[model samples]
Target chain A: MILENNFDLKRMASQVRRDIVRMVYECQSGHPGGSLGCTDYLVALYFKIMKHDPSFNMDGIGEDLFFLSNGHISPVFYSVLAHSGYYDKSELKTFRKLNSRLQGHPTTHEHLPGIRIASGSLGQGMSVAIGAALAKKMNKDQSLVFSLHGDGELQEGQNWEAAMFAPFNKVDNLISTIDVNGQQIDGPTDKVLGLLDLHEKFSAFGWDVMHADGNDMDGIVAALEEAKTRTGKGKPVMILMKTEMGKGVDYMEGSHKWHGTAPNEQQLVQALNQLEETYGDY
Target chain B: MKKYTYTESKDTRSGFGAGLLEAGRKNKEVVALCADLVGSLKMADFIKEFPDRFIQVGIAEANMICMAAGLTIGGKIPFTGTFANFSTGRVYDQIRQSVAYSNKNVKICASHAGLTLGEDGATHQILEDIGLMKMLPGMTVINPCDYNQTKAATIAIAEFEGPVYLRFGRPVVPVFTSPDQKFEIGKAWMVNEGADVSIFATGHMVWQAILAGEKLAEEGIDAEIINIHTIKPLDEKAVLKSAKKTGCVVTCEEHNRYGGLGESIAQLLSTNTPTPMEFVAVNDTFGESGTPEQLMKKYGLDSSNIVDAVKKVMKRK
Candidate 1:
């Protein structure tokens, strides 16, 4: 899929950040800090890197597939999926509401367009991604499988289980990215539990590890493209992306307090003013 | 009561192995994953026949369950093979989130259920798996009675389009059920017909119930026997029909009485048609290291227990 220059990827990232704050404010619930932090990475993946279809099909047989392990950041995922034409952007209004396809966490139960699995429980996406990659190999489909996970969620033992299985099984058609914002729900990840050398840890687990600045669209796109090249070479790839807790909103930045709490109306206005309205609000 | 005779005895896990091979031949989409218990799970034939479709997930049951959920995404029918304890309780959160709640078409084929696992002690012998699996929404729970029925169920669940938990046993028992009998998901098979009492049994308890029926017959008391293969969907029509005829019920299973077949029958009867009932199951206790026969006898899961339950339930009516 060729990148459409006319549709500026950076501009789309700003719009997605705006959507994240507004949706969280409207619902009076949801995680805005992580959502805003991960906006640029998701925007780059959907708009620039991934060769997926906006004509949503659950079984992404011939298309690139993605799973969200840290599903609390549903705002950015919902926004990118909508703005990319997976669904109507107007449906963003139903986020976290009863009878809404946009659930608090990503789920396939409601027949949501882009989501393939329910992943709020954490540390399950990489394993699921590996399974899909294995299926793609069986079917001789060269499409790659991608997944995003939280730095804190890596504390879950299941991720390490998957991390071990992927390289051992030679699952080369998978690319997993970790949002290394250094903050979790409780506090900063280092204060909570230090993940001293993430790259070395992944390297020890037999994965091709790379580093990226998640807040920068150029760096995010470049790292994702580099990860793709490393595939089909007898190992799985991992990109440790460094980002801020809240990249756009001023007050919410650099703290774990806004990890789950929604911004109030006045705060939402302040956040929106900071993020240029490249696209109109839902 | 009618007598049942079998030329040989085989473990239900072997039946699963045979059925897996057949299912693989029938559909190219059938895939198997094992958590480092291939020989115990009896999946060698499948792995040998279709090497590419088989995945060795090692000792990680959580990863195995989640990966099975993922394989279903690209239209692969994934059957995860492991011990019952590891299959259900050990990785329940993964099954709940990725498989049950997402409604993935993954078959959890669990062997070594109940006391019949033998000598592995209370830790490996999971008596509460039925309750754990049955409580999950969109999960089909099936505990086949014998080898033929287990083999049939293994193939049958592949055709069903939702999460399924197929529970079987490790000990070699009578292959009394037919080799050619068709397996239906929520349908009950009437073993013997009588008016005195109705005996509903599943898994290893079916043979015990049959034996109990024969003993009751010689004593001039006729007993009706029904083999309940599928536990979740419960075959309400057949259960209610038998309960209405006999006016009393004796539910038997190789599981805990609190959340097993007996409790499900009680809930069904109390709501639609209240009836006198007795339970022939492990009374909320764990099993210890012993032979299958010794454990069954000690835990009151033998034919004598069923006969006692039948007589007790008859008096209440």
Candidate 2:
């Protein structure tokens, strides 16, 4: 819970972005675009905000819970979790390989810490996050629940169903963040479908809505702080985080094509050069 | 010894509600989550009594299912409440990935199952839930017969830690079982002990099996009735033992004949203890709006149907 508003979150996000690109390049089959874009949010949450011991314990009781709704972007989540000590940092090379805990999507079966639910098909993670938050409330623990979803994943009706249910049910202990990256697998999200007025939409759905620059660590830190302060007030909170499709990677940035595809070796090297090897490449 | 009898009938969903409330009191880790069907799933009492332990997840069954899976990682036992259809079919992938495959200990409490859901039509009635859930690797499937049994199954599965599919129904039926009868998962309940033919049944079908047993007994054909509550682990021992003794089997359920208890029984009998088998279940078809009894009769799921299937299987034997 001791999150420094500083530590150059942008630089940390840059390192996480490099991890996303390099890890995907090693795996040769992972989502890098959304992972790169969402690096700041994940980094800010795990490295700064979250109070978790990443020894990767199976029973994550008395600890904060995080669910990945748009789990295709496992690259960023894996990087953040690994960097924060959920597993051997060297395990990043095993991503998407057979028998790796870091699968192409998030799953708890592998006994990985920080991931409580297996999510690949979009729009289910928030409900599970609310479930854990409800469990925390029942356990009389004040730990919060955090989750992230893609802008395109909001098109799935389940998100709105969770949207309507959370506030009305007083799931105020959950803090859900949406990666409003405006780009998805096929193309730019507007071309795919306009995720129109996401802020007002969640507001109408009975959530206390906030907006922040997802790629800006300061904004993420500040918004997350506000999200925590808003809990226990009888309403769920959602942060509409606007971020770029491939934030730190120069070539992959703003490309929907990189959503599920991995960066090649040359591209990985270029991405790494742009980002300092802060924790050293896994 | 005195036998328990039913003076009245009640919906199995209420039994689930009672079980949920009891589990809430007994286990501090027990939590309930509903997908907007508070009244239909009958999770209102648990929600009211343990307001902090209850979660209203709106109509997001997929989300509700996955969330229940997550709650288990925190050592909290989550029982998900929803219609049989939405609980299984709508969110099969979610349950498969999170709860079943991940091996999370989430109790999937489904009500208003099969044709007995009535008036709401086929959309609400789920005839294939047993099949869908049984396919999962570590899933424990149970379809309780009556109020006491359903309530007992609910409380029992909470003690045995794992993923469970607890199926019950909407309509009021027989409440013959003892109020405090302890439920044993994957164990068949022998309601009658005759040698003519074995009637293996579950859910609301248990009452019909009892009625059919009486009718068969009246006709000089002795009948044996067994309640196959826990469908997945398939009480193979009980089923095979009874089938071996009887030499003929008739499987009855309010679900589809394809993946319901019958198929499992048929498979077990063919490989392990092959016996002539007949199924009194819904043939691959949909349900419609009608009284539950009317639907039971029309869809060939009533007591008479069980009698006919038994006689038919007996002739084959």
Candidate 3:
């Protein structure tokens, strides 16, 4: 596992947020709200919590693997993957471009490093993560499979199906996290269709459910470390991470308007200015 | 005319069961997933032997499909077993995005395909599956003709990489193909050779094509019979050669005429051979509850139908 002392995670989180906004601004199309919201959690995992290799082998045997279920948040995922040294960080500029490896959504067909399955469709990542976890068990590999999903995406029935499966089959090596920003394309999750009590739903599905303040880097790190301890018992672990939509940027924070919208030239400058260039811009 | 006969009949789903068991024995990476249709899909033997490898997703076809796609990441060749209706139409998006577009090495083995899934009626029977599977890019769609062929195809796809849709059916059908025959994907098997008309059939229709060839020989109208099993990467060379010699073609399958083997053959002929053609398939209608025999006759998917189509296409020629 990589040590948190090697680099300042707060600085890295700021840089990741900058990458997210710039990616969406450059493309004029891409998801930014959820990507910004989930930045700190990803920074904590990739930089401190997870044991992974940046050389980027798809098989990912004997190494911790992560899958982004809500693939529209490609900006944050691509940035985190690049910053973690999976590929040349300059490739972040090509987000959503024709023939670029950085597709609008994460895909394996482009042969992108660090991505095993393509997941733009909501509620699919949990099942894939469970499958990988099952494979890890079959191979006797001790590493765990991690996946992130949008809480609004849990409204998809497939998540519940997979939710029931992981715990029943004793898939204890998997850790599934949900970005509970409570915002989707249509509106607030509660207004569109309330996901009443995620903790209860997951607990009823026989998972070891826990909550985290997703925007807080330390809290995410502590919660993830705690989740790791909960593994290998008998049930899968779920981190119900509560984050604000567009957490970093002042105007975009805690609103659904920026859920999928790109910032204008002036707004881009404003958003980027809010995030410190701790690691410099790509 | 070459003679073909069978002393016994067996369901194609049992062929899948036997084939899956053999695949599991041959490769440790071969895993099976079923969505509450273990007995129907004939995956019981596989589940019994390799209980750890088999995943019972319990009525969630979408989850089963995606999980199979995921398993492929760790070098596991996943075979998802369920009825054809739930396999193709029910979870098409998941299959398209996660399996097809993602290009995962997943074997979507489907049983009880088409109108032959009798007594269960239209809701259970999926006649449009062949079309649905074939349209996906990089998907290999194989509808094996009989028990032996289905078993052979099931075993063969485990060796071949990439996504495949193996369509088979319920009801006992004659096992004409050899059990030891090499099942090659995207290749046509020449059942019989003739000069007057070409009869290309798929799925459960190959036996009927052979029977039609025999009756056509008795009528002095020589008919070429070919089993076109793999539909997506069609045997273009074989199709063109036969269509050129016969100057007419008759495509048979237990599927809708709109997107079945007939349409594929029509596209092939229009592009390469431009041969006159007739279709012995369902014409845009859903199936009703009945015996497999009754459905075959009513839907014009029997040997008599093939013979009649051949005669009609010959007049066009």
Candidate 4:
């Protein structure tokens, strides 16, 4: 609710992209590909779409819930959360450091605002999203639950379990999106474990599936709007976002190698040049 | 000898169902979720009274655990229902991350615990649940003795914030705990007091310990019976005081000997005040399909086991 009218989601995206690099570089380890890929969409969700308070309450109380199912990309999730006023942006430098609130995987025990559950183990956030949606239904609150997952994480049997559950149980208050970067740690998702056709799979599971260019802020915003319309229909909505491994930065773009390996001093400088300090470095 | 009047024996899960309905009425935030085990977990009352508040997740315990964790974020105290096997070992990672590590105030209500689950066999019975839940850093594990205590504990956890694991049994057991006794989380309740040996028991074993103490008294053995309901953040003061005075101890539970209440008591005594102790529990084995009484005896978890363990430990004293 503290979101300002002057808030430019694109500016937020740029700053987030910068922090994504800074954190990965500082930690010398993190998933930059998916983090870079989801920057614009995460920006749209936090800066534009969702309503939350930055005073950092774990129990969001009357506020919308955002869950990160694929927790390895803590760099991007951390950047967006820090940017949105959950914590001092300067705290971003401490990502993955000992005793830091921002661990390798995001944890609510740290009492960070906007994050409800810890979901480093993928395929869980969807169910967690449904549960939160169910809570909203119980409380009679109209707030929606949002969750993001990696495309590779779909291979987890629990994802299909949740996919089957949300639709069948009428968990319609949730909007779940997948980070379809098509790349994971081992190799291309097809090589590691072929996802085959994600759309048909989700469609068969009864989710209202929508595809979007995740890097384009406008497309993400529009798709989210379309997703919102699909809500209250007694069926959960899934957005399959097509994105480059490294979307904005040219050197790291389109490769799974950047998925977890962080940029060194020179590489970080090169990456940061592509991302302007719109909101300043976190 | 006076003959006791025939009343009724009910599964503790039914008590949970009754308690859920009452808790929903008392607290506006208490919402219940079940992964297709509503009838089995005895959550029908809550589901019937508050349909909007009850969620039927359809045989997905992993999803159920994570979702319950998420619900806590919006200031909702979610009580997730499933069998003890599904609730603990099946979804340990989900609970570890979402509920335990994140410290979400979700109540993991596990029904049909231990060999008492019966007939369904080892696949259903969960002897390791107490150990599994207690190992978590910030978890409060409670194994209520009977129907009334199970119901009371269900209502009790709603008010006490933080993560809780409420374990209950499936079989129809004697409901003898005080109907009006308040459910306190970590304080052990002194059921009866004697001096020869201290009998610290939990879950269905509480009633068994009482029976064993009564039998031991007739044989000129003085026994102190204590109900250690809350397993984690254990009532160390009560345990040590009784063990130190009696100079001997016997721990009983329908759980594994490795990480169950026996191990906890052993640790307490070995570290602070060492005392002779014997364990009356399953000895590194799984249970088979049988009646509740049969499994208890086969697994050596009956009151006779407690009685024998007490005598053995007292010999060391």
lDDT of 2 at B204: 93
Give the CA lDDT, 0 to 100, for residue A98 in model 3: 95
lDDT of 3 by residue, A1-282 (tens): 254652488889999999999999998999999999999888888988889999877778888889899999989999998988888889999999998999999999899887888889787888888888888888889998889999899989999989989999999999999999999889999999999998998999899999999998778888999999999999999999999999999999999999999999999999887999988789
Pairs of residues at least 3 apart in sequence or in different chains that clash in candidate 2: A128-B67, B35-B58
* Residue-level lDDT tens digits of model 3 in B1-317: 88998988999999999999999999999999999889888988899999999888998999899989888878899999999999999999999889999999999999989999999999998889999999999999999999999999999999999999999998899998887999999999999999999899998999988888999999999888999999989999999999999899999999999888889889988987688999999989999999999999998889998888888888897
lDDT, ranked from best to worst: 1, 3, 4, 2
Candidate 1: Cα lDDT at B274: 99
lDDT of candidate model 3 versus the reference: 0.91
Shares of reference contacts reproduced by the candidates, in order, are: 0.71, 0.67, 0.63, 0.83
Q: Give candidate 3's root-mean-square deviation (CA, Å).
A: 1.2
Candidate 1: which docking quality band? high
Cα-based lDDT at residue B93, candidate 1? 97
Tens-place lDDT digits, model 1, residues B1-317: 77789999999999999999999999999999999999999999999889999999999999999998889888899999999999999999999999999999999999999999999899999999999999998899999988999999999998888999999999999999999989999999999998989999999999999889989999998999999999999999999999999999999999999889889999999999999999999999999999999999999999999999988989999
> What TM-score does chain B alone reach in each candidate, compared with the true chain B?
0.99, 0.98, 0.99, 0.97
Candidate 2: list runs displaced more than 4 Å.
A1-14, A56-61, A232-234, B1-6, B35-48, B57-60
**lDDT scores in order:** 0.92, 0.85, 0.91, 0.85
Q: Root-mean-square deviation of each candidate, in angstroms?
A: 1.1, 2.8, 1.2, 2.4
Q: Which portions of model 1 show Cα errors greater than 4 Å?
A: A1-3
Stretch of 10 with least lDDT, candidate 1 chain A: A1-10
| Residues B247-280, model 2: lDDT tens digits | 9999999998899899998888889877999989
